[model samples]
Target: MPELIFRQPDGSTQLVSAENGSSVMQAAIRANVRGIEAECGGACACATCHVYIAPSDLLLIPAAKEEEEDMLDGVCAERREGSRLACQITVTDALGDMIIDIPDRQY
Candidate 1:
């Protein structure tokens, strides 16, 4: 399992264990981490699970697909080079200690 660190908009952080092969959104939902609404339940249909991956961890995970990229256009937060949909990032050993920042609002 990999450990994920979520940095909330309020400057608080939630650390959770993510099972390999599971989506980051799934782990956040399981741990009840705030800021990740996951309205589409990891379907990549919505931007509610938007997160900013740490620049250092960017290469650890695969790049977002076209569908996820398209959905990101609707995110309420500013989209940066590190922005990614949590539902599109699968937990893997390569991502041993990933850190993501949640926006202030998803809606």
Candidate 2:
């Protein structure tokens, strides 16, 4: 299992273990992480699971698919170079430890 560190808006952090092949959003949901709403339930149709991946870990993630990019345009927070919908990020051994920052709001 890989570990995910979620930095919340209030500056609190929650560390959770993620199963391989599960989305980061799934791990957050299971851990009751506060900021990831995941309104569409990891379907990639919503931007509620938005997060910013740590820059150092960026290369470990695959490029976002076109559909994910489209949905990203609707995210509530400002989209940046490292912004990603957590549901689109699958956990893998290669990812090791990932630090994701949750935005102040999801909607």
Candidate 3:
């Protein structure tokens, strides 16, 4: 199992094992991490699962798709270079031990 490190808004971190092939948002929800709402249920329509990929881990992730990029415009936090929809990020061995920073708000 891959380790998923979730960084909370107050700077606290929670480490959880990610199920194989699950999205980051799903894993967070399963763990009841509290920050990711995933209102669209992994659908790209909502940016409720917005998160920021740690700067150190950015290159490992694929570039954001157009739809996701567009939806990000609605996120509560201003978009940054590392911004991404947690639902679009799948857990993989390469992404094991990944670190994701939750934004201040989910809407």
Candidate 4:
């Protein structure tokens, strides 16, 4: 299992093990991680699972697809260089111990 570190808005951190082939949003939901609402259940239909990837980790994952990019535009928080939808990020061994920051808002 690969672990992911989630940084919440309140400055707390959570480390959760995510199985390979699952999305970050799924792992967050399964682990009851605060700040990751995941309202659409990893369907990519909503932007509530928005997170910010660290610059170092950004190079490890694929760029957001067009649909995901479109959804990001509507994110409640300010879109940033590393902004991404957690539902679009697949967990793999190569992404070991990656850190993701939950935006201040997910509405």
Which number leads on TM-score?
4
Per-residue CA lDDT of model 1 for 23-74, tens digit only, reads: 9999999999998999989888889999999888898888888998899998
Give the Cα lDDT of each candidate.
0.90, 0.91, 0.88, 0.92
For model 2, what is the alpha-carbon lDDT of residue 46? 84
As for candidate 3, its clashing pairs are none
Error of 1 at 72 (Å): 0.7
Task: List TM-scores for all candidates, in order.
Answer: 0.95, 0.95, 0.94, 0.96
- Model 2: per-residue Cα lDDT over 12-101, one tens digit each: 899899999999999999999998999999999989999998777889999999999999999989898899999999999877667799
Poorest lDDT segment (10 consecutive residues) of candidate 2: 90-99
C-alpha lDDT of residue 105 in model 4:
88
Predicted structure 3: lDDT = 0.88
For residues 4-105, write the lDDT of model 4, one tens digit per residue. Answer: 999987888999999999999999999999888888888888899999998878999999999999999999998999999999999999877898998998
| Candidate achieving higher lDDT, 2 or 3 | 2
**True-structure lDDT of candidate 4:** 0.92
The residue pairs in collision within model 4 are none
67, model 2: CA deviation in Å? Answer: 0.5
The RMSD (Cα, Å) of candidate 4 is 0.8
Q: Which residue segments of model 1 deviate by more than 4 Å?
A: none
